[model samples]
Target: MKRSVLKFGGSSVSDFSKIKDLADYLKSRINKNEQLIVVVSAMGKTTDDLLTSVSHLTANPNDKDLAMLLNTGEQQTISFLSLALNDLDVRTKPLTGYQAGIETRGHHLKSKISSIESDFLENLFESNDLLIVAGFQGFNEVGELTTLGRGGSDTTAVALAAALNCTCEIYTDVTGVFSTDPRIYSNAKRWEMISFEEMMEMSALGAGVLETRSVELANNHNIPIYLGKTLSDEKGTWIVPNDQMLERKAVTGVALDKEMAHVTITYPLDSKTFLTDLFYKLEGAEINIDMISQIQNQEGLQLSFTVKESEEKDLNYLFDVLRESYTNLYVKIETTYCKLSVIGAGMRDMTGVASKIFKTLLTSDIPFYQVTTSEISVSYVVDENYGEKAARLLCEAFDL
Candidate 1:
């Protein structure tokens, strides 16, 4: 039988009414000859609510315990969804991440999938027309429950699709991928189709339509993903291989990442050892550095890099450790900054894209703190106040 995987986000299964509506959608998609797997996230803000409740119990709970608590959210969805589908006379079964044969590696709350048993899943489909698998979770070697980080449900869905050799569809709140976030830019154009490469870049740059890891997995495995709104009939966006892209705009989209903080360290010019040690320590701590710059001055060589705001707690402790070794080290952190980026595959051979970006911002008097570029992307770090204007002006300049 031809099989397919469909992933619904938290918003899609937020309540009983939504789950009932989803049951109808699944029945419409199911046929006697084809088997299907449906993956789902925790209903609405259940996961977040669980976390908030945890904070009230204890500021720092054990990671294992946290995973155990959070996994229940998805578990509830599967049980409720399974019941709804059964009420509709659809043969369905609810499976946890482990029961579905997903094995994971890495620590709790941020696990990476190690492997999946395809035969087990194939066997389950023999009798049941549809299997409702919980998303964003898996079991480790020690048999402890672990959750994938934010947007892990998307990753879970894509991984399952790759393993089963089936097409993957993601249903979310948005109708399609826009040239920019519609919430920020109301006039942003919606894309019918986007290249995998472009979509991956945008996802990483904070497009939020799809998780970056999910895009990477889909691109690597030659899987195409369809993203659309739940309970809507509008045609959504398709993320396919580059060769399949229909709109080849030079500037595909403008993306903004607000959860960013810039860290600048002024170290002595002769302190090469200090610079090396800092990076080595960051690597060991699993800190991701983005948009780095270095400049030599009469006093010292100043180093600057951006990291997710969530890392501030780790960085603070690391700085305390470093001060013991280098007493003269000077550091500054700006939490009031946002990273803005422009991405497109067409920019690979295009000239003057960077110049146009700088000119546009310069003319608008939006001063950027740091700038970085890739084959198909250019990023700027600007004050939070200027982020919206920068995106709007750049979108207009590129005619995105």
Candidate 2:
């Protein structure tokens, strides 16, 4: 018998009616002699609503209290789901991340699961019943409750599957993963499978279907993940391991980062010491850097890099950070930037992939402010004003 983990999103099990539908799916699946492990997120908008209430009440809420409150969303879902399963004559138990021995490192919010006990899970499976585990929230080593950030639920599911070495499938609202977000581009195609590296880049570049961290965990553990719409989930995208080497099209996907900002630092005009010093300064500040571009000229070499806009608010803090670290380099920050990416397996060996991208943008009359490329991806930085137009034109270029 095959063991699989099926995780339902908030929208999939958002309410009483939706919960009933899921319960039915579980009951029927249980009849297949297939060992089932279930993970679910909080009901629709419950986490968001709870956070809104918190923001209104306190500027700095207690982390422990906040986790406790945030966890109630999934708690309610788990208990309700257990009740519905009981109604269908299936014996089952629902365990929160912590109760299932999912120990983590986070104090309150954004805790990473360190290990899963699996003791209770071993006992619960004797009845050949389904196990429903709450997603997102877990406990630290100190036994304090903590929530994984935005994609907590997905992380929860992936973690459990990794710990148990079970087949994990993520259920969303679409049939499977599309070439691009269908809502954004009507021509976006769907891939039957994609490598872990490509998917991780996509998630980092703002692909909303899956979370970046979850993909990392799944990739590390060599686990397969399937993404499909639960509403009409006939088929979804299955993420599988691949070492296949084939020449891919000029571009497999186009990714955009709207909330992007760039920062440039100049050290003494002539020292190799300056570049090294600036990177160390930024690292000490804990500001994640992306697409670091460097240029060497008679005047000091110019070092440019990108960071998300969400981190832009703390830009000035880095100035103090740089001063404390290097005490010698001059720094400047720029926020009016956007990043566009073209990813494919064949980008490394392909002759004119970069040329095609440039021509596509040139024909659209959009000029790239900066361009960065890796073995499997090419990224271009442009003015934020044309970010949307650039993404649309790029998507339409390949009929994606």
Candidate 3:
């Protein structure tokens, strides 16, 4: 039997009315004979609210306990959504991550899906018209519940689609993928279709519409993903195979990452040991470093890199550990910075793309701290205050 994986974000099923609307929409779309899997996130800020409630109990909670607490939000959503469907006489079965066969590994608060035993899910499909699964939470080998990190519901949906060998549709608040975040650049253009390679780049570089790991999964499985607004019949963006992307643009879109922090470490000159040790420590800590710029000075070697602001705590601890070695070391942290990037597959053969980005920043008087380039994208770290302006300027410069 053919099946489709449909995922709804938090905002899509925030309230009873929204859940009812979703049930009605599903009723209209599902063929009586076909199988359907629906993955849903916690309604609205329920997850955040849960976290806040936990925070009131303890500032430093155990990772395992935190996961146990956070998983409840998604469970509530799945159960409520399933009840709504059942009310419509749509034979629906709601399952938590573990019951649905989602197996995950790694730390509790942030875990990677190891594999999914789909036999249980297949069995459920035989008896139900719809299988509703909780997103973002799974169980480990030891049977402890774990929740995937932020935007994990997307990962859950895509992984299920891949496992089930079906097409995936992600329903969010946005109508479709756009040239840039419309909230930042009001004139951002919507895309009808985007290549997986381009979409992967955009997602990795801070396009919040889809999770990076989810895109990687979709690309690896050659699964097509459709993203659109809920409660609407409008056509949305399709993330398809590269061969399906016949019309390529020089610049596909602009992405802004506002949650970036800039860190600089200056150590004694002529000390390659310090450089090696610091890098190894960062690697050991599993910190994702981006846009690194190193300068060798007469007095010292200065290293600057960009990382997610959430890692400030880890970075600070590492800095403290290193301070013991380099007594005179200097460290600086800038939290009010963001990365603005332009990505497209056409950039592989395009010229003057970097120049255009630079020209836009210069004309707008937006001073950039650092710049990095890849085959398909150019990213610049700039003041957060200039983030939107820089995106708009680059959007116009590249004609996105």
Model 1 error, position 58 (Å): 2.4
lDDT (10s digit) by residue, model 2, range 154-191: 88788878877888899977777666667767778898
The residue ranges of model 2 lying beyond 4 angstroms of the native Cα positions read 62-65, 231-233, 244-250, 264-287, 294-303, 312-336
TM-score of 2: 0.86
Order of the predicted models by TM-score, top scorer first? 3, 1, 2
Clashes (backbone N, CA, C under 3 Å), per candidate, total 0, 6, 0
TM-score, candidate number 1:
0.94
User: Which residue window of length 10 is worst by lDDT in model 3?
Assistant: 26-35
Off by over 4 Å in 1: 269-272, 296-298, 321-330
| TM-score of every candidate | 0.94, 0.86, 0.95
Better of 2 and 3 by TM-score: 3
Instruction: List clashing residue pairs in candidate 3.
Output: none
The residue-by-residue lDDT of candidate 3 on 175-247, one tens digit each, is 9999999998888899999999999989888889999889899999999999999978788999999999988
Clashing pairs in 2: 173-229, 174-229, 176-236, 179-189, 187-400, 188-400
- Residue 202 shift from truth in candidate 3, angstroms: 1.2
lDDT of 1: 0.90
